[model samples]
Target: MKAMEWYFPKSREELAELLKEEGALIHAGGTAIKEERIKSAKRVIDISSLPLNYVKKDGNIWHIGATATLNRVIDSLESDHFLVKALKCTATTPLRNRITMGGSVYLSPLWSNLMGPLLALEAEIEVLGRRQGTCKYEELLSDRGKFQGCAVTEVRFPDVKLIGWFDRFARTSTDYSALTVTIALSVEGESIRDAKVVVTGSKKVYDRLSGVEKALQGSRLEDVDVEGISRNVNVEFTDKPAGSGAYLAEVSKVLLCRGLNALGSAR
Candidate 1:
């Protein structure tokens, strides 16, 4: 392994200049870099020196800087942010303190705990650098190539009546979920007026579950049929970490069912 040269840019201007290099990687909380498979990455742009580390409610949207840690996000929000709550279930305290929003978005690894929740939240990302790009939550989860050469400066979400539910199907508490689901529901008179179902931890990363959302939109909680859910829902495992596809499929269905059922019970 070669000794690496680190670049800590104190401003976006400097960071932007550093990105002109061919093999540079953005280092935010540095936890992901701490696990870097490569000894030398041309340059590690230490964004912690930059000014992208704050959370604020601006008008009707929550603007979150990329350097903000998972724990910071959880601590910063007072009102129950379903997305944050779901992410809190991802890792232990110390690990959460280092894993970053920007790092996660860039990595989008197989077992990402934040992806499903972010998908369900309908989050929007603001990127900086040579080329700028904006992608909807679903688009980001679906096509990662769109993010090439982009630096995530901020992520924003509109304020709404957000109800979030998360379930991690794991052998134990600390284990990563074999399958995880995050549900955001907006209901009126026990019928879902708007719903986002983010199912992750399978091979493909996540499913937006538009079909399920459409079915849920006008139906009351009591009318949400579990049998229909088992039949209607479909997600192909892009990468099956857990063995037995059929078994995991059943487990995924059960976890999603319970999560949705919990949302109904809360009403």
Candidate 2:
């Protein structure tokens, strides 16, 4: 086996220069680095020492630094905050302490519990290389290959008031999720002004249920047919150790309806 080369960059400029190296991979919390694909990389850049571990709110926007651990971010949010609800469903406490917000967004594995909520919130990520500006979370997911040289610096989203609910299905509490559902609704008076539905652990990694969102828009929360809307939506899944594709699809629909119902009850 070949020895791996490691780099510890002390500054953003230093990190950018190191990222220019061929096959260079960023290591924040080092949890995802255990993956076979990431383990094979010959060069690793650790960015934990940088001043990126922060969680703060400025006016109406919330900013979370890239190196901030999952627990750290949760500590800064209310118990009912969407991010707090979704992140609490991730790995065990020990692993959650080692999972960084930036790393989760960058890797976006099939079982990631972060991506679904981030997508539903329309979060934006700031990068430090190649694509140096801020880009919507969805854009980064769609064109990830184009930003290989970029290092995720921060994640920011508006502090919009919405009724949020998140749920994940797994055989065990510590097992990877077979399906994760996230729902956020903006309610005005007695109607839903807007809605965002996202599902993770699907064949496509994660997806936004635009059809369901459209159906919920401007509809009275009390009149929503959660079961019908959930059953009619199409979401493909791949067979995994957790469950068969068909089984997971069925589970996802059930969870979706449950999430919608939870949101409606919260209103």
Candidate 3:
């Protein structure tokens, strides 16, 4: 094997040019890429100098630069926000400080803690390269090819008030979760207007519980059948650190029930 080449692109235009080369991978925090085999790439494009590190609120939107670290996100959002809860539950302080939001979102790692919350929150991202435009969180995740040769500039999240919940099941606090769940409920008075249940660290990578959401819609908190609705969620998992697919699914239901109960209690 030959030595890998490296380029530092200070601007998006330069970054695009560098990305045109085959086997050229963007380096944000490099946490995910570093762990993978170097044979996967021939060149590395460092984007640290790019102006992509920021966290600002623009009216009803929250703009987070791609290079913003998990720690940065936690600091930017309110303590009660589901995003903050997810980030805080991800890893230990040191690792959390090193993991970049862009890297997390772009890679969409199987053990990702960011995906569930971001998906549930309906976040969008700015991409520059082969795809130079904004894409919905679901679209980007479902079709990763759209992200190839692209640099994720930033992630945009809506500024909305809602009751949220997040849960993760791992052997230890630092261990990769066997399963992760995030729920964001828009409760208008006594009725549940909107509900989103997103789960990751499963065979499907991540999924939104539409069936459960529909069941909860228009239903009062006290009328919710947390156990039955949770059981309806069908999640599959490959060989995971925690347990078998069946075991994880069972655990997921338990977590779902707990999360829903917690959300109801908040009201």
How high is each candidate's TM-score? 0.90, 0.92, 0.93
Question: What are the lDDT figures for the candidates, one per model?
Answer: 0.75, 0.87, 0.84
For model 1, the run of ten residues with the poorest summed lDDT: 236-245
Which has the better lDDT: candidate 2, or candidate 3?
2
Model 1 clashing-pair count: 3
Model 3, position 206, has a per-residue lDDT of 80
lDDT of 3: 0.84
Write candidate 1's Cα lDDT for 1-267 as tens digits. Answer: 566788888887787788767677777776666555446575677788778888889998888888988788888875467766666776788988888877777676644477777777678887767656565656665666766666887777887776778777776777777778778888777677888887776656667788888888888876788568758877665435454667777777887888878877777
In terms of TM-score, how similar is model 1 to the real structure? 0.90
Residue 100 lDDT (model 1): 80
Model 2: per-residue lDDT, tens digit, 170-189?
98887888889889889999
Candidate 1: residue 162 lDDT (0-100): 69
Worst 10 residues of 3 by lDDT: 33-42
lDDT-better candidate, 1 vs 3: 3
Off by over 4 Å in 3: 1-4, 35-41
Highest lDDT model number:
2
Clash pairs, candidate 2, are none
Of candidate 2, the 10-residue stretch with the lowest lDDT total is 107-116
